[model samples]
Target chain A: MTSASPILIIGSMAFDDLELPTGSAHNVVGGSATYSAFAASVFAPVRVVAVVGDDFPEEMLGTMRGRGIDVDGVERASGKTFRWAGRYDTDLIHRTTLDTQLNVFASFNPKLPELYRDTPFVLLGNNHPALQLDVLEQTRAPLFVVADTMNFWISGEPQILASMLRRIDTLVVNDEEARQLSGIYNIRRAARDILTRGPRRVIIKRGEHGALLFDEDGIFAAPGFPLEDVIDPTGAGDSFAGGLLGYLSNQQQISALSLRRAMLHATATASFCVEAVGTQRIATITREDVAQRVDQIRSLYEFGASTM
Target chain B: MTSASPILIIGSMAFDDLELPTGSAHNVVGGSATYSAFAASVFAPVRVVAVVGDDFPEEMLGTMRGRGIDVDGVERASGKTFRWAGRYDTDLIHRTTLDTQLNVFASFNPKLPELYRDTPFVLLGNNHPALQLDVLEQTRAPLFVVADTMNFWISGEPQILASMLRRIDTLVVNDEEARQLSGIYNIRRAARDILTRGPRRVIIKRGEHGALLFDEDGIFAAPGFPLEDVIDPTGAGDSFAGGLLGYLSNQQQISALSLRRAMLHATATASFCVEAVGTQRIATITREDVAQRVDQIRSLYEFGASTM
Candidate 1:
């Protein structure tokens, strides 16, 4: 294995109040940055840059630090931390957002620390496009940049998102967000439209169906690992992005082969995320566990080539 | 190439009135046997056993005969043909059934001819459980038997469906039917529950999402061919089953590898079915066309084995 580079993650870190059919949990640690950091840390060092309130626990930061995640870039301000409350249906596929308290995250302005300015890999977690662009501007000639966005930012910050799209090398979004962003129902056409807008590569994450990677080379689909039960699905998409970039950071160079393999790793990590609430499963799992799951996913899609 | 064996298909032949998002078509020739016969005819000889009314067009049967699909088993009764009218949602994912006139189909009792009884491969199309069982009883020592079912029969004829399931080698149903029949939301679990019931193999079809095959060998997933537009999805499932059994009949022996490769052909054929209102595309396409689409579908899921 090559030496792994640290991935800079910029987004929010907060507490989630989840009402799942299996049960409910309050003050669960979650958020784009939090989930991404834990997932990425499994394969490489992670640098988190986000703001939390003084009410946030220092022990969580210590836990991350123990896992080789740098928390020096994390800003702790005066106020309650960002808290989101959501309720999931029995199917666990759809959820309704019951509340959102931005708290210190409302004024989140990600500032790259001096030591983090030269990080070669950056993961702009799902956030406002302007803020993502701000981090991109601060980076000094990064080797790769992957930005994740959602419907809220696509509609609210279209112009800025467009600008961010041009700057980022890869754009990741869920299936619904891809359609909403491109105004196209067909995912293939949507990815084609997004390619013209800016990003050279688009990864559309479909919850249980699996994920598709569209690049100049061609399309590669990774089958989602079949889980008997899902405890939570709060940060599956972010965890996928985290694992993708995390695995890519260890590669000698990013190529079509590398990207496709990275997607398999991403799929494996995301599968573990949904097995437990928040990042419980991802945080506790080892690299070997991920590799094993990767093999399972590969077998799921593997078949002999058609000779007819 | 191995010499192909003829496949005996039993189901209904009827007239369909479709209201699609793109347009509308009235008096369209369709039904389970019709679609399956056309799709399977791409690879092997297809013997169709179905019931139609005197109002059915004689030229339609002539068309099937031209394609190497035997229509001697098709019964022409003295009544109007079964007619169905449905309107699709704008997304084309859901539809509202406007009308259903059972007509002659209500009395469909499949009685395979003596010649068809010797056919080694049989495809039991979606219909009442009793009718499906009636066809199964008529078949001699068959090398393989594949059956398709729907929700109406599962809910209405549980005992009969259970009996039929034990007699078939393979059972094919869409994702919804799998869940409804097994009473499990998770598809993997649903398939597991189905495996205990009787059939050695269970194929869960997820329309645009592709299809999954589960058996004693484990599981194999075939990605759905990405289409820019789907004209109509009326007979895609039947076409899928038809192509699957068709390709299987041409194989020297049905093993894990053959079954997996057959799924690719099935996916390719089903992709073409949705390109037109009824079976237009599948009926017109040559074997080479289906092979080319199979190659494309294989690429959609092909990737390097993970070394990380």
Candidate 2:
């Protein structure tokens, strides 16, 4: 294994109720933090900062611990855990949220461990922009900070999201959110507009089509690894973020080359995340499995080019 | 200019009325043959075989001839030209066909001229499967054959489409049509299933997202060049088809490397197609213009990869 760096991730850790066309599962161990931490652990040591409740499973935490994830920053609250219930469309790309019970998560506050504050990489997963700001304030001067946001926050709390955008090195958003955030239909133009807002780079995730990385250097397009069967698409974006930041943390320096390589790892990890329900597929995969998939994904874009 | 070879194209030749959010245009020169012939002329000598009415503009035919496109195979019937009207959605991806008057086009019987019978490359543009078969039968011995089909024929006439599929070297269809034709939602699986039906390769076009080439050698993905403004997407697919086969005709042989290079040209040409209302941008560009765009698009996927 390569020299692994530690990545600090701050987001929700909760139980999920998922309804797929094939079947349904309740009380599935899920959340932005749960998926991100597991995916990140494949490449680097992960420090998760989130709030779970007394009812949350101890075995899942132990599984994460066995995978090299540090849970010292996880707060064990007295009340029930955060829970989300959603039903996926036949396409698996669209989902309708049936319920969101904040429970203990409603009043949760993130206080990072001292060791996490000094971590070189930080992933601020989807949450209220104000809460993301609170976590950002707790961290020391990290080398890189990547944040993910959705349409809910963009419309509900724009001012806070705008403030949070200014503090991060990269902003990862799905294509629709990018359009909603920028108010521009043209993706390249929308990304250019977002760059002026604050983030140095914007990664527009087009779930199945692929992902595009827009920064001052130019645009980098990475094709999503085409799959025969995508059993579940939950946590794909977060997994992509975790894998990207995780791989970058281990790099000696972040260049265009390194960023491109990180995208390869990110795409591979997300492909595995959708292979089965919840995080079952990604949680069990090793670093070698990710590396193999990375090779295969890279082949999708390989052509005989003498120069760029 | 690189020892250009001849490419025969068979499809519609007509006028179109296009409505866009920017504005609307009437009597714009368009059709599968018109777009493909113009795009093909950049890298090859194009011979167009289609039926146009007496009302068709001679000036447009002259314009095509000026670009190395031979219109001798164009048969002018005694009637109004085929006319199609469509309104594009604000997104510009979805369009509602307002009207389609297949005047002389309804009687389009593509018969290759004696000189064109031996053309080395052939692009059987979108038409009825039986017409495509007629064009294929007329060709003496072509080095390569690439055909484009749409949903209209896939569902309207499946048996004939299947027969045409077996004789072609490659089949190009948009993502939706690919899914419908293969009865599979997963694109990779759809393309795999398509290969079993007959064609040696399948190229699935995903409009603004990109294109995927699936063959026995494996998959090759070419990203769509992100444009700041897309005035009209009419004829973009046919333009891509023409550019690919045109570029391939000049190559010594069809191999993985040649196919990849052809896709670069195809993508570059299609990007230009959407820059204007009809075929204005593609019609006005030079060979060097295409090469420059090809370089720019190649940079989208370029990384420091030493090997596949």
Candidate 3:
């Protein structure tokens, strides 16, 4: 795959304070746009469009610069970076947000830089659907437009969510969000309904269970790798979205083959993401580690039939 | 492949009352034994063993007899069969048990006949753990044995379930139950934990997400057919287990290949189980339908490898 430059990510950029069973991690680098940019930058140049506050460490920007992540559109203002304090109950599968301080991120808007406007792929991470729609309007038409959303949007702004789907090419959401958005309990049906809205493809991320890719013709199932343990699942989804759109943008192809491969790759990346609290697990990981884990993830679910 | 006589299941035979957003179907034929027998009968000659009251329509038994399912084990007694009423609030995925009357099933115990004793495979439906254990003890050592349990057993009587797992060859539990039983969130690890306790294999059924099979060296992931609308999810899991064990028993080879194939076969059967309310959909399904759907499932996950 050739290197894709200026891969733009329009979403949240802030800090996540997480409490996990193992231990508590504070001021860990988080936010959909931040983790995604950090993750995708490993494969190609990443341009982020998000807002942070004065408290957003300049050292983090230095770290992004070290990895070649461009934060040209990451506006810094006189406010605290969005701070979210969440606790992963004993059941690490689900978490309850104790508090969400949207601070600088609350009224923020995404502004695509001239260089990022025509980026081959634009990834809209979990945010308000209206903002996602606004981001799509600003981005230059490219190879594909993929958007991710949360349950809040599904239940609160479904009309906006449905209408916004028409502007993007691929939709990524958790399994619950998909079911809630489509009013279909069967995931395949929910994806089919979402596809009807606009995006030709849908990816349902089933946190620990793995994910499914539903396109026009068929569905593919991938099993999650057994993470020795998940320290904190805070930013796993954004990392997955980052890895998915990153692979798609880098490959510059949207065939079934590419999507399946991307699903595996994205899942593999997320597997590493959960190994530690926040995005620290994936920050230092190498592409070779990802490649190796991808093979393992595929083999985890590999089966062959014999005429015998 | 030759047709084989299925292990007759005799237990609660009842119609479920369910309210769904898609559409409502009343008095849909359901109950553990009913779903189990219908699922097993599709692949082989099945015999049901249970007692129903006057309210229990004789035609339902006739329908089983018409399908080559033997109702000789069905004992018509007094009051009513076990009736469960549930409502699907939002997604048909989760149903709140509105009401459950033990009815005639409260004190029923299954006694296998000489013909039934010799059967190679037997599935102890989800009932009191002691009752299920009793049925297992009564049946002669068949080729294989599996028992299903609910959260009530897992939480109410852990020791009995654990000991029961030791006596049986297989145990089918839902995702949450699997976690509760094993005290682990990582399914792969949970499977390993269950395998060590008693059963040679552990099957974790993740409702619409499909199922997972874990043994010593390998793990297989099966994604459920994404359905557009789930009318009523009641009895889907029981039907899935019936088909899984039914297929494995008939195929009669407990190799890795057979187990994996059986998982897929069970999943395909469950897909049909959800089309209508309760047993009505599962009862009408034919083997050809199952085999074809299984093939479709295989193809959806199939991939051509250019290099390995």
B68: Cα error in model 3, Å = 2.4
* Candidate 1 lDDT by residue in tens digits, B86-150: 99997777989999999998887777889999999899999888888888888888999999998
Which sequence of candidate numbers ranks them by TM-score, best first?
1, 2, 3
Point out the higher-scoring one by lDDT: 2 or 3: 2
Q: Indicate the DockQ of the complex predicted as candidate 1.
A: 0.62
lDDT of 2 by residue, A200-245 (tens): 9999999987789998778988788889888888898889999999
Question: Which candidate leads in DockQ?
Answer: 1
Model 1 regions lying over 4 Å from their true place: A304-308, B304-308
For residue A236, give model 1's deviation from the true position in Å: 0.5
What is the DockQ of the complex in model 3?
0.36
How well is each residue in A53-122 modelled by candidate 1, as lDDT tens digits?
A: 9989999999899888999999999999999999999878899999999999998888899989999999
Model 1 gets an lDDT of: 0.90
lDDT of each residue in B140-228, candidate 3, tens digit only: 77777888888888999988887789887788889888888888877778888889899988898988778888876477777777666
Segments of candidate 2 deviating more than 4 angstroms: A304-308, B304-308
Is 1 or 3 the stronger prediction by lDDT? 1
Q: Which stretches of candidate 3 lie over 4 Å from their true place?
A: A1-6, A21-23, A106-114, A128-141, A150-164, A179-190, A226-228, A304-308, B1-5, B8-10, B21-27, B303-308
